[model samples]
Target: MLIELRPGTSAEAAEEVAARAGAHEDVTAWPVRLAGRVFVVVSGDESLAHVPASPAVLARRPTPDGHWLVRRDSGVAPREVTIGPPLSGPPEAPRQVGVVGGPRLWWAAGPCALESTEDAVETALTVRAQGAHALRAGLSKTRSSPYHFPGRGLRGLEALAEIRRAAAIPVITEVCDPREVAAVAEVADCLQVDGRQLDNRPLLAELGAQRRPVLLMRGPRASLDDWLRAAEFVFTRGNSAVVLCAGATGTPQQPGFGAITALRARTELPVIFDPSHSTRSASLVAPAALAASAYGADGLLIESCTKPERLYRPGDAAHMFPPESLADLVATCERVRDSARSLEVSC
Candidate 1:
């Protein structure tokens, strides 16, 4: 069990929370501080009812999956994770699911990896003009095959920083290794964890400690409960700014649109879709993206490039769509969202 004290909780209140929790037989309580927030973690097999009836207590919840993210979806509090010092933040508070102006479909379009400084900048600018909220500039990639071209390392991070500067928009990038979390957090407005890295407790804990907004992709074989439990890997440490990313499931033919709908009914955290990854085909991405929105995805991370065919890894073009198509899809998503809202409002 974890007891969350309100933000700016005083030391006395924290100690009191710990002391009261400690008084429970067979349970040990400790004070924890992370991501600039304070909370008490009670370790035991059973829940306690002796919680002090004080205003200092913000919430008390059980971490049944050994994680304490079991909060109500509608109880999301307003918070912001500053991207970085140099780059600008989102136009508005992001990660707020299903809000006015549409779903939290903060569009992010870019190549799977950084090709060149010039190409990254151009793609970022084009996507921003196409109504994207951020640029998906990956600094490092974990390829499936050993012979495939792995991404540029530190150079990629530097290039991404330059992309954010030139494009003047927030950047989202992947952190493949735990050791590089600090460096990646400094450059990326939001940190991304690949579906392959869902069980990387070390990496997720580091990201949680780094205190940046994280976009955690759902593992292909993991259940919805597994997905939320993985998110607890971050939330329990302190950072509350998390967005659940739904990707390809076990089947090759279908996207995780069903997971998106089910997750919508389960958690309040912003749920987004990665059509480019789910379908792995430029042609299939368009329909998959629309279906994700219709199924209640809060945002999207669409793979795009300046001219994908000209990429160093030409085979990557199979999954990347052009920026013009991204613009068309963005506009169409608005209309689709409007229609869905109308039906809900009337019914």
Candidate 2:
């Protein structure tokens, strides 16, 4: 639950009310502002309970647009304040250990094999054309098969460095352990904590120590409460630049899961959805992307390959959409966001 303060409300008065509101059952309180209106966003069972239940401001209402705006009369006139559906903004400045590039539409790419510098450059070009703000790939893979090609490790990190150098886009890679965290930190712009490693508290702490933006994936089996606490492990270290990645649960849900819904409701960190790994069917990518956007996700971290058939990964081939398909999905996501914002005006 998010709260916004109205115009003319004193911060001190608002803070006092918020403190009282926070003490209500199951409520988590935070303050937000838009166009000079102060808001108190509440979560848990205590959200609407603390709002003035009087005849003037007690009722919940919606604007002509689809957004839910809190309507209350401040004695003189009725007032409405804006509260954003979840969104992500770039930090004021790149932290000492994070990506140099700014905030953007991120696309996680999977290049299963190590390729030449030229190949990486070409791939990065195609990715940029698709409007991806940043590119994600695997430098050190944690695969099920020990004899498999795995990842290029340092060599792949070098390739990613070259890709960033050539394309001038931020590059993200996976780090499996503390040593790899340091090693990957040396080359890539961000370090990812894979969903499988969700329980590895040690790695979470180590990544926090690096002070880079950590993309923590939600384990297919873990609860949302568990996921956020894991995120807090990093934040408690004073590293606030953390992001969440929602993938499919390993069960029949394959690509989408309750975890997606649960995490979106609970955490304020930016979350990116992984369609390729979560929904194994290519046909599901468009709808999944649409659903995630509608639910206020920070962004989509999809895998867009120029040619899915020619790729060297184990994910669903259909999910590895062509550039055109990916473009369509992105457009749809924009439409959903527009529709959500449209809800604001109708009120």
Q: Note the Cα lDDT for every prediction shown.
A: 0.74, 0.57
Model 1, 1-347: lDDT tens digits are 77878999988888888888778687777666655667787766455536777788888866666644534432432223333333334343233122211334567889988877898889988987787778887777777787776778676876777788788767788888999998877667788888888889899879878667888888788878777777777775567778778888885546878887676556666778899988889998888888877776677889999878777765788988879778789778767766775776431
Best candidate per TM-score, number?
A: 1
Q: Estimate each model's TM-score.
A: 0.82, 0.64
For model 1, the local distance difference test gives: 0.74
Clashes of each: 2, 22
Cα deviation in Å at residue 282, candidate 2? Answer: 2.8
- Write model 2 residue lDDT over 163-242, tens digit each, in one string: 76676556667877776777777656667777778778788867866656777788778666567667655543334557
Candidate 2: deviation at residue 49, Å? 36
- When summed lDDT is taken over every stretch of 10 residues in candidate 2, the lowest stretch is 76-85
